[model samples]
Target: MFRFLVGRLLILIPTFIGVSLLAFFPIRLLAGDPVALLSGERVMSPERHAEISHQLGLDRPYIVQYLDYLWKILHGDFGVSISQKQPVLDQFFQLFPATLELSLCAIIFAIIIGIPAGILAAVKRGSFLDQLVMGTALIGFSMPIFWWGLLLIILFSGILQWTPVSGRISLMYFFPSVTGLMLVDSLLSGEPGAFKSAVSHLILPTIVLGTIPLAIIARQTRSAMLEVLSEDYVRTARAKGLSTFRVVGVHALRNALIPVVTTIGLQVGVMLAGAILTESIFSWPGVGKWMVDSVSRRDYPVIQGGLLIIAGLVMVVNLIVDLLYGLINPRIRH
Candidate 1:
């Protein structure tokens, strides 16, 4: 296991380097100049442009700039955000917990709702319940998150007024951001109604963000369970007079989970990508919204740095998922 972990860590070195290269080059190729965008409405004079360029090392050759960026990254300097006027890493860390909280909640929601739905669908294959579960999963999978989020806002927030439209919490709450996670921070602050406010604000966006993953996980689980249920071991368990629950829950589901877990692991990337749309729609203060803003302003450091950091995070999640395989099924550790 140690050797396996070491090997995976070693693989990430080149993977991260490749990600850095991809993040760095593409942003520079974009048409808008970050310095010019930084000037806003004012026309940037040549001197002003040169001054900003020099300050940002944009005056340097592409190769030199790329090398310098990499060197700084190696030294733990993500460079300053031209727009925010803060360290890129600092801004990222500040926003990351919000994204983490949302993604974690979204995944948890998916797992709790999806897995059981899947198990039921598998147990009653070809029945109305199976069709209903599969049909809902299909529709959820097909729905666009942005559009769904808008519809939700229109119905729940606009018409019914059941949830807050956007933001992490109601403006009425003044919770200090201890962990940068609104839910946790609100509870810690002991601010009256803050936790409830946070949860209410979270519900719409969480549902929007989690929908696709829930669909995917449910389908994956159902498929895996169905395949596992047909195996000889499952039949043996049944023939041995094991309770239906024991046969399916202990034996079938456990074996089915290996592939289902892999599917869930792969969905981490999908979740992050989906968060970009969900966060933007919900105005959630997260790395996704930050990246979108950076793109508009052509904030090169933030864009490149954010992409690299997010990509690295995805890779880390995938590695952790791979490690989890050993825990779920010990044969993989060999």
Candidate 2:
């Protein structure tokens, strides 16, 4: 296990280098100039444009700029956002908690609802319940996140007036951002109604973000369970006169979870990708929305840094999932 972990960590070094190279070079090839975008609607003279480019190192050769950026990255510097004029890492850390909170809630919602639905569908293979569950999962999987988020806003916010249209919490509640997560910060504030307000605001976006992962997890779980149920060990458990719950839940589900867990791990990347759309639609003030706005303004540092960081996060999650395989099935530890 120790050697396995070391090997995985060693692999990440090159993986991150590749990710950095991919992130750095192509973005420079994009048509828009960050300095020009930073000037907004203003028309600058040639001399001023040249000065600004020189100041920002845009006048430097692409290879030179990339090497300098790579050196800075190695020294824990992501550079300042060309638009925001603040450190990219600082802005990212400020916004990341909100994204983390949303993603965590979304995944939890998916797991709680999806896994049981899957188990029931698998247990009752050809029954109506299975059909209904599978049908819903299929719909969830097929739906576009942006379209679904907008529909929810139209129904819940526009028509019913049940949920907030955008933002993390009601502006009525003021609290210092301890964790940068509205839900946690609200509770930490010790103010009246803040927690409820935060939760109310979270509902629509959470549902929108979670729906796809829930569908995928449910489908994976059902498939795994069906395969596991046919194995000799499952039949042996049933023949031993163990309760049906024990046979399915303990024997079948545990074995089935190996693949399902892998699917769940992969869903983290999906959730982050979907959050880009969901956050934009809802104006949720997370890293996804931040990155999107940066793209429009051609904020090179934020774009390159955010992509590299997010890719690194996905790699870390995959590593954790690999480690979890050993815990779930000891044979993998070898």
Candidate 3:
């Protein structure tokens, strides 16, 4: 177990470095000159541009700038947001709960719906039910988040008027941000309908954010279940006259979870990436939308820092998943 954890931790170093390289150099290069992007509509004087560039150390060689950025990262200094003029970490922490809230809700939503659907489909393999599950999974997997969100908004928000079109909650509610999660904070406020309001606003975003992961989990779980159902242990359990639930859910599903867990783990990263679009579409005040806003404003420090922080989060989740995987199926530890 120790060895497994150590191995996973060791992998994070190079993975994080890769994330840094991808997050830094490519974005800085392909996004055009930061100074120019920051200028927006009005053309700025060349002198002002050079001054801003020098102030931002854009005047230095690209390698030097990158190394300096890495040095700052090592020192736990992600730098201040040029647009917000606040420390990146400060803003990150303040805003992270929103993203965290969205991500958690999305993943939970996925797991709750996905696992059951997968199990059902697997139990009825090669039937119409299985075909339906797989077909729906394919459609869910293929649907673009932004388009899906808009479609939901049109149907639910615009046409039906069932859910809010945008924002984390209604403007009427005000509560102390005890946990930064709207649901908790709203309950803490003891205000009427606050919790319900929070849940309502969360519904659309969660569905939109979770759709792909749900699809992936469903497919992965079904595949894993099918494989495990044919295993010797499962067959023996069935032969022993164990109940259908015990044979399938206990013997088969338990073993099948290894791959499903891996799929869920990988989905965490995808969830975060999807949150970027989901938040934008919903105008949720989370890190994803913040990152998008930062991009428009050309806040390079925020962009780089946010990317690193998000990458680090994904790494942490993956590590936890690896550890869980090892515990559940010890064969992997070897």
Candidate 4:
């Protein structure tokens, strides 16, 4: 296991390098210059443009710039955001926790809602409850995150006033900046009021982000359970006088979870990367919002840094999923 993990970790260097190589030149290849865009063409003179370019190291040859970027990356210097005038690493770390918190909540929400609904749907296939659960899953899968978030905000926050319309916490409650995750910080500070507000604000965004993954897990679980529940071992367990629940729950669901686990792992990365729209809608100050803001301003460092982090996360999660497959099945370890 150690050897396998080391091998996989070793491959990440080249993967990151390839990502940088592909992404670096594209900004210049595109129609506009980053410096020109930041310093508007209307008021900027030739010398000012030259200064901006020099500051960004755009005046150097592409190869030199690429080598410098790679070297700085090795030394944990993600470069300064051309627009924000802050270190890219600082900006990334500052906002990443919020997104991580949001994504964790979203995944929990997906699992709690999706897995059981799927099991029930598979257990009672062709029944009204089965149809109902599957139908809900279908709707969730079909709807867009932005649309779902809007509808939820309108119904729960706007009309009913059950939750906050936007933001991480209420203006009334004070939360410490310890963790950058408002909910955790609020709890640590023993502020139930702030925690509640943070949770309430989280509801709409989490639901919108979770919907697709929930639907996917539901469908995959249903299929997996359907297959496992009909296997010879299930019949053998039932024939040996095992309780129906034992036969299904212990024998069937345990094995069925392998595929479901894979889906969950993949969806974790997706939810993290795809939260841009949800974050924008809910005004959540997460990585997604940071990426969007950076992109709009042509902040190459932030854009590249964010994308690099996301890619690394996705690769790590995939590696975890691969290892988990062997642990769960016990068949692939050989």
Candidate 5:
């Protein structure tokens, strides 16, 4: 287990460097200058631009800048945001809990619904229920995230008034962010309707973000369950007079989860990346939305730092998944 973890960590370093390269260089090549953008509607004079560029070290050669940034990253410095003029890491930590909260809820929502749907679909493979589940999965998977979010917002928030269209909570309730998660914080606040408002605001975003992952997990689960159900052990369990639930859920699902676990692990990365789209639509103040805003203003530090951190997180999640995968399969540990 130690060697396995060490190996995974070793693999992470180079990939993380690649991610830094992706995050750092491309944004610098973007049209327009952050220096000019800083001045807002008025264009800065060339002399002013040069002065600001030199001050911010933007005048340095691209290779030099990348090397310096890379060095700082190794020592855990993400530099300051070009636009916000704040430490990028500080902003990231402050906002990350929100993204983490949303992503956690979204993935949980997917797993809770998706796994069962897949299980039933597999068990009743030839029935209408199976077809309907798979059909819905197809639609959910195919639908664009932004468009789907808007549709939900219109239906639930606009017409039905079932949930908030955007933001984390109502402005009526204010509380210090003790844990950074609104739901938990709201509870701690002891304010009536605080937790309710947080949950209601979260509902649409969770549904929208989780919908695609749900489809993916459902399909993956169904496929895995189908394969496992046909295995000799599953039949043997049934022949032994094991109950149907025990035969399918216990015997089959235990083995089937090897691959399904991988799918769910991969979805964590996808969900993190996908949050950019969801956050934008709903105006959720998370890393995704921060990255989007940074792009518009060509905030190189924020963009690079945000992407690098998010990439690292995705890599870490994959590593944990691999460790879990080994524990589940056992054969891999050998």
Candidate 6:
């Protein structure tokens, strides 16, 4: 297990380098030059352009600039965002936690809703309940997140007035800002009102972000369960007079979870990507929205940092899922 982890960690270096190279040159390929973009109208003067280029090290050869960027990355420096004028890494740390929280909540929502629905659908097979579950999953899979978010906002927030429309908390709450995550900070500050509002804010976005993954997981779980249900072990359990629930739950579902686990891991990354749209709709101030704004302004550092962070997260999740297979089914570990 240690060997596998070390191997996976080592692979990140080259993978990150490749991603950075792709991110770096694309900015250069854009319609305008970085120096001009930085200096704005002032760069219209040739002398000013030269000064701006010198300040930003654009005067260096392309290879030199690339090497310098890589060197800084090795030293844990992601450079500053040209637009925000703040350290890119600093911005990433500040915003990534919110995105992480949103992704986690969505995945948790997916698994809690999806796995049971899948199990029930598989167990009931051709029953009306099975059809109902499958129909719900279909609708979830077909709907785009932004549209769903809007519909949810209209129905839940606009019409019923059950939930707040935007922001992480109600303006009235005075919670401590420890981690910038309202739930955590609210609990730390002993502010129940803030906690409630935070949870309320999370629900709509989480549901919208979770819907597609839940549908996928449900389908995968149903298929996997069905396959396992017919296996000899399941039949043996039934022949041994094991309760139907035990035979299905202990024998079939456990074995079926291997693929479900993989899907759940992959879904974490998907949820993060989907949060871009969801966050924009709800004004959630997470890494996703930050990435979108950076892209619009051509803030290369933020864009590159955000992409690298997300890609790194996905890779880590995949590796963890691979290791989980070994633990869950010991045969795979060897």
Q: What is each predicted model's overall lDDT from 0 to 1?
A: 0.92, 0.93, 0.91, 0.86, 0.93, 0.85
Determine the backbone clash count of candidate 1.
0
TM-score of each: 0.95, 0.95, 0.95, 0.92, 0.97, 0.90
Give the lowest summed-lDDT range of ten residues in model 4: 23-32
Q: Which stretches of model 3 miss by more than 4 angstroms?
A: 31-33, 36-43
Model 3, residue 236: distance off in Å is 2.3
Q: What's the CA RMSD of model 6 in angstroms? A: 2.4
- Writing each residue's lDDT as its tens digit, candidate 6 over 45-77 gives 898778867877878887798889878877888
Model 6 spans with C-alpha error above 4 angstroms:
1-14, 31-44, 59-64, 330-334
Error of 2 at 84 (Å): 1.3
Pick the winner on lDDT between candidates 4 and 6.
4
Roughly what TM-score does model 6 have, to 2 decimal places? 0.90
Whole-model lDDT for model 4 versus the true structure? Answer: 0.86
Candidate 3 lDDT over residue span 1-334, tens digit each: 8878888889999998888888788776555677887677889999999999899898998889889999999899999888678999999999999999999999999999999999999999999999999999999999999899999999999999999989877899887789999988998999998899999999999999999999999999999999999888888888889999998878888888889988999998899899999999999999999999888777888999999999998889889888888888789899
Give candidate 3's TM-score: 0.95
Candidate 1: segments with Cα more than 4 A from true spot: none
Off by over 4 Å in 2: 330-334
TM-score of 4: 0.92
What is the overall TM-score of model 1 with all chains considered together? 0.95
lDDT of 1 by residue, 225-310 (tens): 99999999899999999999999999999889899889889888988899999999999999999999999999888998898888
Name the candidate that leads on TM-score.
5
After the best TM-score superposition of candidate 5, give how far the Cα of residue 17 lies from its true spot, in angstroms.
1.4
Query: Worst 10-residue stretch by lDDT in candidate 1?
Result: 170-179
Determine which window of 10 residues in candidate 6 has minimal summed lDDT.
34-43
